[model samples]
Target: MSFQDWEITFEERTEELVEDYGDSWRLKFDDNIEPDNPAQDWFQYIRGAFARFQCSKCKKTWPSRRVLVVFHFRLDGRKRKGTVEARRFRQECRRCQEAKMEEPQFDSDNIEVLLEKLVERIRMRCYRETLDGIQRDFRPVGRSEGPHESSHCEACLKGVCRKAE
Candidate 1:
């Protein structure tokens, strides 16, 4: 919801997607209706970003670049169409005793990087295409020092993140 103010405009995302999936590719904000299950053709991947978080109770703000977001996508080769679903992860305020899992906030730069990596994954997984360069890591342009706080991460708490694994 808060990501509506993303610095990366929709046009930029569309252009990036069009370059890979062609002009018929569509980006939809998934409502997550049915389930997390992906069909046979659907490919699932994880995208991480440096997300900012503000505690509602304590009003404490912090930056974390390891926020894990899940994505499900598929490309219909015959139709030359594609669909993507993004699910943002949340984190709790470590300082607040009754803290709720707050949605992570991302900047334009992070969004741009995330989308680029996502499209790359789509190209490889769905289209079975190989890239010339080495595979890139999800390193967003931001600074968040110290070890990752698994205690505050919703994915870690739910045993879904790599740390939890």
Candidate 2:
């Protein structure tokens, strides 16, 4: 399938999976199954995730309209690893970007920090086909995955910022 179509499907699957599972696998199914000769599905799947950005200056939120990318590298003590990034996302308010460039120290306007959070959200959203593929082809037991439960801190939910600053 084409990559764009893959993203929508991936997003749906990730949302569905996360509702039940609470997180994506650190290494996706195909990543684990065929590590030595890994399939390119991980790249295909991650390309579909979306990260939205909210302008701290104007408080306007927009879909970053950026595709997430996975970077692979080797560490001295570890096997090959991957991390996601939205490095090219620059669609935010021009004024904000200009302000960031001039100051570069405002916590709220830090592009890297924004991109990091965006990447985190994108990563949380990219595991549908992987899990579905495995379950469809290889679930030996019929047992349910688990209960679907939602948890939240009541204070946080009520918009009360409780942290000491």
Candidate 3:
């Protein structure tokens, strides 16, 4: 179905999600389904989810009502401060999915590509959150010149400075 067609159904699902998650607003899909293009399906599911309301972050009506999809990964090795890592999928417009379906078969290679995309998405989201937190904490300090003007670490100071500059 076209995204426009899917939008109608997606709206209905979003209401259910609001009732279910309330403030948290997280939706986890079962991985067993094995969609033709799991990444596309993942995007479609999230787009459907956000169709219900305005996004808290962007404040813009969710474009195509899409939600960023991230895949969480953890290594089996030694102690790490943060055990989980994530990556996000590229925004898959519904048109892409429809077009992709015309191909003969969606195989493991496709899924692997999707997995990588999801991982990237997660990493970007995590980085964004970290930056946002740093900004929130340091906002009161006001903009400053020179390295030592801000109390934040050099990395953070550099980032903020770059953003300002």
- Computed on alpha carbons, the lDDT of every model, listed in order, comes to 0.69, 0.29, 0.26
Could you tell which candidate, 2 or 3, scores higher by lDDT?
A: 2
lDDT of 3 by residue, 84-164 (tens): 222222221222222211111112233333333333343344222222222111111122232332222221222322222
Q: For model 2, what is the C-alpha lDDT against the true structure?
A: 0.29
| Model 2 spans with C-alpha error above 4 angstroms | 1-48, 75-90, 94-165
Once fitted onto the true fold, the runs of candidate 3 whose alpha carbons sit more than 4 angstroms away are 1-106, 129-165
Q: Kindly list the per-residue Cα lDDT of model 2 for residues 1-165, writing each as its tens digit.
A: 223333344444345335654543222111122112224433322221223444567765433222222322111213223323211212233435442211111122222233333334444444322222111111111222332111221212233312221
Error of 2 at 144 (Å): 36
Q: Give the 10-residue window scoring lowest on summed lDDT in candidate 3.
A: 44-53
Give the C-alpha miss distance for residue 12 in model 3, angstroms.
Answer: 37
TM-score, candidate 2, is: 0.25
Candidate 1 minimal-lDDT segment of 10 residues = 1-10
Output the TM-score of candidate 1. 0.74
Ordered by lDDT, highest first, the candidates read 1, 2, 3
List model 1 lDDT by residue over 2-43, tens digit each. Answer: 445442343465575577556455555653522346667787
What would the TM-scores of all predictions be?
0.74, 0.25, 0.20
